[model samples]
Target: MAEVLLVVGVVVAMFVAYNIGGSTTGPAFGPAVGAKAISKPVAAGLMGLFFFVGAWTIGRNVVTKLGTELVVDPGVFTLESSIAVLFFIGIALLVGNIFGVPASTSMTAVGAIAGLGLAGNVLDLAVMGEIVIWWVVSPIVGFWVSLIIGRYFYARFNRMVAMERSTGPLLDVDRSGPIPIPRVHETTNRRELVGTITVVAIGCLMAFSSGTSNIANAVAPLVGSGELAMDPAIILGGIAVTIGAFTIARRTLDTMGSDITELPLTAAIVVASVSSALVVFLSMLGIPASFVIIATMSIVGLGWGRATRPVTVPEAVRKEKAPPVTIDALAADEPGEELPPIGEEDPDKIPQASDLFNPATTARVVLMQNVVPAIATLGAYLTFRFVPIFGI
Candidate 1:
């Protein structure tokens, strides 16, 4: 019976790790894939590699916290309790995937453990409060930081473009023939070099941070139950997460990259960087956080805030204007010239109203994207809260 239960617990842990990969990898690789900077397969492969490295190197801290630190007593988390936690988190992630939301596996794990701890009389209200507070603050901090960075970069780009325009080199215009091109000096600028270095550094940091903070989400329960040692847990968790990233992370990636907001590479880097910093900080402090919510909100808020204005249709496409109909002057007088039948009304004509009011669709898509993730988080919480009575 003990062996059977252990096997079951391991299976549940694997499911939890798979869900983590689906939720977290989407954010980690979504922007790069959406920007066309990398293909989905390449992103998945890279994420898998980095995730393993991260889990092995720095994931120990988070794993220890999740398995041992949050509650008043570690003995309260029995095999049954661990399985219950995994079930709740897994259900929540499954719901998020179905609804196309990028829910946070970290949040789900925290909520489940908290619920279980309360049931087992091991609740530590002080630690729980701190964790909840970070949950609230992390996303807000991520958003404003991303917003500031995005705006500053945009301003700098505009200034550079304006300066180049003012330099006003002689232009060759041809009225009747092609103009000859002139060769100019090719040199990299200090700004470009600095920006490139900063972006690469941030990417590395984000990858490392993600791997470290999320390791606990998968391996903590197993460790708590003495089913696995720290080193083996980290190795298993890392490999499992990498596999999850490569297989199930694509849909959520599309939702984040294309549906929430159209993020430029720079804006993506800023959001990812800010989110990673917050996650790392929380992990170090032994606080639990939701990375998906933080990263998604940051990217969406930054993208929306940076848009020049709400999208509007061109005047030529508005519905108020009547379509111009031409009647040939000669055809009007000649009865013998048969009037061409109004070309069969095309069924595939684009709706003018839709074109003008396109922002509504964008808004709906964004709302759904955000709401689905939140619902998933809540679902995980509720599942664990009611698990004792439900006997899951």
Candidate 2:
């Protein structure tokens, strides 16, 4: 019976990991695939490799936190309870999908575990508080950082990083020699090549960050239960994520890539870099960061910063004037286009506000994102506390 229960626990954990892979691949590689810089297979391969690298290294810190430190008593993570927690997480994912909102797997997993801890009267308030604080603070930090960049450096960065791909294949493989050689196509300029590489590299970085933070979400319950060793559990989770990257990840690739297309390439890169860096930092400290919240905040910050460019910070604070809100912040400025200083740029040149970053829309997204995690926490707690079946 114990062996069978363990098997059931492992299977549920794999399901969670599989969903994680499918959900994360698009955010990591969407830009590269969208730009035609790499094929889906190549993106999946890179996602798998970097994800493993991250999971094998800094990801352990997070695994330990979830599996051992979050609760006062690690023994509360019995095999039956662990399976129950995983079920709540899986339900969160399903709910998020049905609503067309990608849930934060980290938050949902943490919520489930916290729920279990509370039900058993083993909840570690200190650890849970710290995690919650970081969850709130990290996204705000991402927003401000991105806002600063959007306000001051966006034009210059856009000029420097933006590249429109030229017609034809980026590289050609020459198999005439014993060792095949790859060469850039005549149509591919140095700038284009560099831009393509940059996109793919950023994608890899995002994948690494995802693994660093999310691997624990998949296997922590089983590991906490002491039925699965940490190393093998992580390896199992990584395998599940890889399988997901190759399979269901295809749909997400299209969804996220299309969304990226709507945003300027430079803006997407900036948001991704800011959010991924924050997630990696949090993971190093054993915190499961929510990339979705951080990225959304970054996007809003970038847009807000760009829109408020007509007034300097001091002027806005002092009520000198109201700056017009505009979607022009995301507009790709041409290279070497001369622009006035921050406050001196003409407001008339910026277009009026659009639905790109509508407040209602953003509020709706933020509210929806929270719903899944809340449900997971409440559901897990109620089940473990009230149901006699789990023997919690």
Candidate 3:
């Protein structure tokens, strides 16, 4: 029976990792694919590679916390309770994807596990409190750093990173070699190549950061329960993530590549860099960072900071604080999903993407994401408290 339960736990862990792979590709590589700097297949491959690298190295920090440190006693993570915790996380992932709401995977995983710990009398207040503190601090750091960049250096950065792909082949084929090799040549404009490379590089950074924080969400419970060792669990989870990258990531590469509030290239780069860096930092500290919240806040900060750059503090207090006629503001009055750009079509169309990042909407979106985690917490608590499988 224990052996059967171990197999079931591992299967659930893979399911969680698969969902994570599909969900994360959009955020990690969307900008590169959106800019046409790389194809979807290439993006998927890079995401998998960097994710594995991150998991093998820095991701262990976060796994340690989820698997051992979050609870007062690791013995509390029995196979039955671990499976129950994973079920809640898997449910959160499924609901979030089906409904087009991007919940924080790490947060959901933490919530479910913490719920298990709480019900089993093993919850660690210090560790949980520390995780909560970092969750708040990291997003705030992301916001302020992005805000400073937007207000001060954004224009210059935008001008510098202005990269358009050339009409010709980006790489020159060398037939002289025994095997033909495609390499950059004199035909490649240095500036355009640099810009293209930067976008793709940032995408890689995002993938790596995601691996750092997210790998633990998939395999930590199994490892905690002693059903699987850390090394094998990480390896299995990596394989599942790779499968997701190659298979289910295509649709997201299209829809979220440009949608999810229509980000410009520079804005995407800045937001990705800031948020990814923050996640990696927190992962190193064994915290399950909330990438979605941090990235959303970064995006909102960039837009708000840039928009309010020309105004003074008093002007901002008097004018900028007023509710702008944004899509969120008019979402009720408007009818359907076919709203046009703010200026290009009818006056009642949705506000420009620039105007959609008001503080209220930003807060609401972040708070909305928490719903999945909250549900997972509640479900986990109830199941462990009453379920016979927990052996309580």
Highest-scoring model, TM-score: 2
- What is the model-wide C-alpha lDDT for candidate 2? 0.88
Better of 2 and 3 by TM-score: 2
**Where does candidate 2 stray beyond 4 Å?**
324-326
- As for candidate 2, its clashing pairs are none
By TM-score, is 1 or 3 better? 3
lDDT of 2 by residue, 270-368 (tens): 899999999999999999998989998999888777777788889989989776544555673677898789789877767764634768767867887
Per residue, candidate 3 scores C-alpha lDDT tens digits across 239-336 of 89988988888888887677734566777788899998998889889999988899887876776555444455676677754323332322222212
- Superior by TM-score: candidate 1 or candidate 2: 2
Candidate 2 shows a clash count of 0
lDDT of 3 at 85: 81
On the 0 to 100 scale, the lDDT of residue 369 in model 1 is 42
TM-score of each: 0.66, 0.96, 0.88
lDDT of candidate model 1 versus the reference = 0.61
* lDDT leaderboard ranking: 2, 3, 1
lDDT, residue 68, candidate 1: 82
